[model samples]
Target: MKIKSYLLIILIVISAVGLSVCSYIYTPAKYQEYSVGVDKEPVMAPMLKGASAGVFPWSPVEKQEDPQSLAKKDKVAETKPEAKIEVVEPKSFTKVDDSYFDDAVFIGDSRMVGLSQYCPEIDSRATFFAKKSLTIYNLQKDAWIDVENGPKETIFDALSKISFSKVYIMVGINEIGRGTNEGYRDAYADVIKRILEIQPDALIFINSTMHVTKEKSDGDELYNNGNINVRNAALFDLIDNQHIFYLNVNDMLDDGEGNLDESLSGDGVHLKGSCYEPWHQYLLFNGVVD
Candidate 1:
C-alpha cells in the first residue's frame, strides 16, 4: 500500500510539470506589437561620467594625460573664444510697449506665407502677407523706372501700412536665381534701407535664404551653387546695425547633405507647414523672436 501511494505521488508531480510546460508553449504573446508608452517615464541613455564627444571629428587621440597636460588643456579652454551666437532677447521688441505696434508685420514672397501658416501663434501678434512670386517691380510696373518686379516686394509696402514694432523679411531666392550676385546684393540692400527709413525704430529680422535640391536649382541658368554663396555673403555684409538682426535659420533646415530636404518643401521652393515648426524653434533659439 505504501509503495502504491509513492507511485501515485510521483505521477502527480510529473503531470503538474508537464502541464506547466504545455501552458507556457501554447499561450499567446502578452504583447504582440511593439509600442512606446507615453505614460511611462522616458529612459535616458546612460552617459559616461567624465568624458564627452569631442568637437573635432577626426582629431588624433592622445595616448596618456599627465597633471601638467591636463592643466594646459584647462588653460587652453579658458582662453578659447566663446561661440558667437546671435541671440536677441524678446525684450528688445517688447521694450517700447507702443499701442501702435501691438501688431507685427511679415512681408515677402511665397516663402513668407508658408512661414506664416507654420507659425499661426505668431499671426496673433501680427498680420502676414505673402503674395506668390510678387516683387516690388510688379507693384510699380507702370512706373517710369521700368523695374520688372523681382522675387519679393519692397520693404516700404510693409512699413507704410502700420507703425510696426517688428518686421521679418525672407526673400531673394527667386530673384537671386535670375540676377548676378552684385545685382541681388544691391537690390536686397535697397529693400533693407527702405524699411529702416520708413520706421526708424522698428526691429528688422532678416531670415537666411533656404537651400534647395540641386535638381530644382538646376532649372535656372543664372542660378547655381555659387548663387547661395554670393547671396549669403551679401546678406552678412550689411549687418552693421544692432536693430537689424540676421538669423540663419537655414542651418537647421538643411538635411546635412548641403541640400534642402524634399519633405520640407512642396515645390522645392515653398516650405510645407510641417517644416515651419523646427524653423520657428530655430528662430526662438537664435533670439530672432522675443
Candidate 2:
C-alpha cells in the first residue's frame, strides 16, 4: 500500500510539471517575462484569427487601401471648371458718299497723280500731295510736291500747313523690288508715324497695292501680282481699325484670278484715265464716319 501511494504522488507531480511547460510555450512573447512579484502590469494579447492568428499576435494590423478607390479619390480632387476668355471683333467698313472725302487728302505715287488729274469730282473736293515717283522711303526726305504759289516741299511739310480729317496712302508699287517685305513695312510704318505727328486728328487709310494685269504679271518676275499680295499682307498687319484702316481697292480692280482687270489698266500698273472712276467710287463706298 505504501509503494502504491508513492507511485500516485510521483504521477501527480509529473502531470503538474507538463502543464507548467505547456503554459510557458503558449504564452505571447510580450508576456513571457510576467512574474507574480513584478510591479509592471501585464499587457493583454491582441485578438487575432484566420491567417494572422499565430504571427505577430501583439502588433496592430494595418488596413490596406484598394488601388481603384485611391485612383477615384485622386480623379475627384483634380476635377474643376474651365475658365472662359473674351474675344473682341474687328470694326467693319461702311459706305459713304463723294462728299465724305471733302475733308480728306490723298498721298501716293503716279497713280495718285492720275487720280488728281482725271477724277474731276475727287479733284474738286480732296487735296492731293502726290508725285510721279513718290515712295514711302523718300516721302519725308524728297521735296516732291510743288505747292501752288508755294515752293516744292516734302509731303509732311505740306501736310503740316494744312488741316485734313483723313489721309489716304497708296505708294508701294514703286517700292516692290527695292527691299524685303519687313523693311518695306517698317518704312511704311515710319511714314504713318510722321503723318500722325503732322495731322494728329486725321484718320489714315492704307490702300492695298493694286494687282498688275495678267500680261504684266506673267512677263515680270519681281513685279507680279504674287509679289504685290505679299507686300499688301505686310501692310495689313499695321491696321488698328480704330485710327488706321486698310482699304483693299483690289476688291474692285482685280480680275477673277487675282490680276488687274485687263479693261481697267493700260500699262498693267496704272489705270486708264476713265478707270479712275471705279477707284474713286471705291473710296466713296468704303469711308468710316467715326
Candidate 3:
C-alpha cells in the first residue's frame, strides 16, 4: 500500500513539470505582444556622442547642435548700437559798416541841411554842401556851405577845393515841380558831370528823392507820389551801377503806403535829424567798402 501511494505522487509531480515547459513553448503570437503598460519607454539606439554625420547638400552645417539648442528655443535678440548725426552751419557774406563812408560828402537841399543839423554821425565824418532851397539848377552857382574857418564857397567851388573819395548827391525835390522831366534830367546830369570833372576818382552816389508825408502828397497835386515816382524813375538814367549808384532814401522814410512816415518829418519834406538814424544805418549797411 505504501509503495503504490509513493508511485502516484511521483507521476503527478512529473506531469506538472512537463505541462509548465509545453505552455511556455506553444503560446500563440497573438498572445505574445510587447507589454506597453509594463515597459513605458521605447526601444533606444546606441548613443553617438560628439560624432558627426556628413552634411546634406541642403544643410548649413554637418555636426548636430546640442539637444537643448535644438529644442523650441528662447531667442536672445542682438542689440545694435545707435548712429549719431552731426549738424553743420551754412556760410554767408561779411557785412561792411562805419569805416566805409568815413570820407563821404553829402550834397542836397533842405534834406541835407536836416542831416547836417541833426545827425552827429554825418557831421563828425562828412562835409555837406547844402542850403534850405538848394536846387540842381542853382547848386553849382548859388549854393554855399559854411566850412571850417574858411569862406563859404559855391557847391562846384567846394568840390574843386577838396578831392573826396565819395560824392553823395540827393536833388530833385525842389526841381520836381519846376520843369519837365527831360529838363530836370539834363540839369542833374550836368551836376553829376561837373562833380566828376572836379573829382574824377569820386564814387558818385545819386540818392533818390524821399517821399513826402501822406498829408502833403494827398493834398498837394504838385508834391504828389505820381510826380515823385516819375522823378525817381528818371534818376536811374544817371546810374551805371558802377561808381554811380541809385540809393532810394524814400524806402527808409516811407509809411509803406508810398508816403513818408509822419513821425519822421517835422515838415512834410525834411526828416528830423534824430529820426534819420535809420537812413545812416541803411547807408552803413548798403554802401561800398574800400
Q: Encode model 2's per-residue lDDT on 1-290: one tens digit a residue.
A: 99999999999988666644543443333234333322432222221221144433344545556799999988987885567786656666789887877889999988889989999898899998888878888884788778689788888888888899999998888888998999999989988999999888889999888889999999999899888899999987799887899999999988899999999988888999889888888888888876
Q: Which candidate leads in TM-score? A: 2
Worst 10 residues of 1 by lDDT: 42-51
The C-alpha local distance difference test score for the whole of candidate 2 amounts to: 0.81
* Superposition-based RMSD of candidate 1 using all C-alpha atoms, in angstroms: 26.7
Per-residue lDDT, model 1, residue 90, is 33
- lDDT per model vs. reference: 0.60, 0.81, 0.71
What are the models' TM-scores?
0.55, 0.68, 0.63
Question: Candidate 3, residue 163: CA error in Å?
Answer: 1.4
lDDT of 3 by residue, 45-146 (tens): 001110123222233433446677755343422334456787543222135566655778998888878777877866778887777778888874564667
* The best candidate in terms of lDDT: 2
- In angstroms, give how far residue 251 of model 1 lies from its true place: 1.2
Q: Candidate 2: where are CA atoms >4 Å away?
A: 1-90, 148-151
Please write out the lDDT profile of model 1 over residues 59-137, one tens digit for every residue: 3434566799999999999999999999764343222322322456776677777776667656556667566675533
**Best first by lDDT, ranked:** 2, 3, 1
Model 1 stretches astray by more than 4 angstroms: 1-103, 136-158, 218-225, 288-290
Candidate 1 vs 3: which has more lDDT: 3
CA deviation > 4 Å runs, candidate 3? 1-95, 143-152
